[model samples]
Target: MIKARDALTKIKPYVPGKPIEEVKRELGLDDVIKLASNENPYGPSKKALEIIDSYLTNLNLYPDGRAFELKTALSNYYQVQEEEIIVGNGSDEVIKLLSEAYLNPGDNIVQADVTFSEYEFGALLMGAKVKKVPLKDFTHDLEAFYNYIDDNTKLIYICNPNNPTGTMVTEVELIEFLEKIPKGVLVVLDEAYAEYVADTSYPNSLGLINKYPLVVLRTFSKIYGLAGLRVGFGIAQKEIIANLEKAREPFNVNLLGQVAAVRALDDKEHLEYSFRENAKARESFYQECQKRDIKYVKSHTNFVLMQVEDADTIFNKMLKKGVIVRSGSVFGLNRFIRVTLGSIEQMQRFWQVFDEIGG
Candidate 1:
C-alpha cells in the first residue's frame, strides 16, 4: 500500500447526523424526525425555491467562477465590498482554503477543545499542530486562547454560539480577546448559527474585520434553510480574502446554490420569521427540559445540549422510535445529547418519544 501523510493518522472521521430516509429504511419505520444537525427546521424561503426552479434551464452552462452576482447581493446586504467575501461549496470548504493558504508543517493553530472538529481537521490536513484550550463554562475561553498562542501559532478558531454546547462569548469579551491577538496570527470566527441568536451582546463581527486580522464565516445551511444547497461564505479584509481566493477551487459553489442564496438573502420576511420561530422553539425546549428536571446548557443557537443518563443508550432508543438526535460522544461529552430546536409539532413528537424511552 502507498503510504499516506503521517498527519492523516491524527484525524478522526466526522460523523454527521443520521439522514431521515436512512433511519426510516434501517428501522423499517415510516415516520422519522431529525433534530440532529442544527439545520433550519423551517426550510428555505419560497422566493429561493422559485429562483431555483427558474434557473433549471441554466444547468448546461457553468456557474460564475467568482460568484459575482451572489457576491454583489451579499455586499449589498452586509454593507461590505464584494472583494472582501469568498464563497465556497460550504463553510467547510472555506475552512480548508484557509488552512491551505496559511498553515504549514511545524506551525500550530489554537481552538477550544470541545468546539467544532473541522478546525482540527483543517490544521492536521496541512500538517500543522492543533493546540486545544479547554472550554470555560461551556463557552470558548477566549482569554485561555491567548495562552495557547505563541510564535508558531498561525490560526485561532472561535466558534461563536459554539456547536454542541450552544454557548457563546459576549461582545465585550470577544472584543477584549481580539485586541490581544498577535500580529501574525489570524482569527476565524465561525458564526454558523449567528442568525438564530437573539442576544443583544453578540458581536457585530463584520465591523471588526477592517481593524483586525479576522475572518467571519456564515452559512446559508443554518438560518437560510439552504443546507441541501451547501452555500457558505467568509468575510475578511481584502488581503486575507485574496489569499484564500488563490486557494479556492473554481466554481466551488454550484449554480443552484448561488441563486438560492441570493434569493434567500432578499427574503427578509422569511429570515425574520425563521429567527422568531427558532427563538420560540428554543425557549419551549428549555421549559420542557425544566419541567422534566433535565439539566441543559443555556443555548443561543438553534440547538440545546442536555444532560442524559447514558447518551449512547438514549440515542439508540430514540433512533428506534424514529427520532434522530446527535449523541454527544462525537464531541467527547459522553453524558449529553445535542438536539436541534424543531417546529412545535416536531418538538411534541420528540418529547413523546423521549418520554416513552425514559429520557
Candidate 2:
C-alpha cells in the first residue's frame, strides 16, 4: 500500500454550510433562508447565466489552460497586465498555489488567528509551520504579525474585511504595515469580499502590488453571485504570478466558468444592484442588533458577527428554524455567531426567528 504524506494529518477538511435542500429535508420545513456561506443573495448576473447556457454544448472541449479571455477580463477590470493575473478554480486554489510555490518543510506562514481558515490549511499541505497571531479588537493586528516574521517565514496572508469576524484593516494601516514587511516574504491580500465593503478606509489592494510583492485575490463567488461556478483570480507582480502559474494545473478553471466570469464582468447593472441590496440588508441587521442591545462586530462585508451567549445552542436552534448561520467556534470565537446577509425579506425572516429565540 502506498503511504500518504504525514502533512495530510495536519489538514482539516473544510466544512461548507448545509445546502437549502438538505436543511428542508432535515428540519421538515419548506421555507429556508441560507445565510451561512456569505453567498450573494441577489443572484448571478443575467448576462453570465445566458453565456453559461450558450456554452453548454461546448462541454466536450477542454478549457483554455491559461484561461485567456477570463484573465484578459480580469486584467482590464483590475488595471493589471495580462501576465500579472492568474485565474484559479477559486481563490481557495490560489491560496494552495501560493503554498506550493513558496512553502517547504522548514518554512512558515503567518496569518490572523481568526480570519480565513484556508491559509493554515494550505500551509500544512506544503509541510510548512503555521504561526497565528491573535486579532486585536476582532481585526488584524499588523504589529503582532510583523513580530512573528523570521527568516523562515515565507508567506503572510491578510484577509481584509476578514472572514467570520467581518472586520477590516484600513488602507493607511495596510500601507504602513507593508513598508515594514521583510523583502524576502510574500504578502497575500485576500479581498474575497471587497465589493461589499462600503468603507472608504479599505485599501485598493490590487494597486498595492506595484510596490510590494503582494498577491491580491478576488472571487466571483461573492458579489458576482458565481459561487457555484467556482471562479476566482489573483493579481500580483509578473514574477510572482508566473511562479504560481507553475503550480497551477492546466485547465484548473472550467470552460463554462470562464465564459460566465467574462460576461459577469460586463454586467454593471447586476453589480450595482447586488451591492446596494447587500448594504441595505446589512444595515438592517445592525439596527436589529442595536434594538436588542446585542453585541456584534460592525461589519464592512456582507455578514454580521453577533455575540450571543451560548452560541452552540443558538446555532442549533437557528438551524431548526431553517436560518443557517456560522458559529464562531469554527474560528475559536465561541461566544460569537456569523450571519451572512441575504435579501431584505430573508433578513426579516431571520430576525423574526431570531426575536423568538431571545435575540
The candidate that wins on lDDT is 1
Cα TM-score per model: 0.99, 0.97
- Local distance difference test, each candidate: 0.94, 0.90
Report the C-alpha lDDT of model 2 over 230-294, residue by residue, as the tens digit: 99989999999999999999989999899999999999999999999888887888888889999
Per-residue accuracy of model 1 over 194-253 as CA lDDT, tens digit each: 988888999999999999899999999999999999999999999999999999889799
The parts of candidate 2 lying over 4 Å away from their true place are none
Model 1: per-residue Cα lDDT at residue 1: 100
Model 2 worst lDDT run, 10 consecutive residues: 325-334
- Clashing residue pairs in candidate 2, if any? none
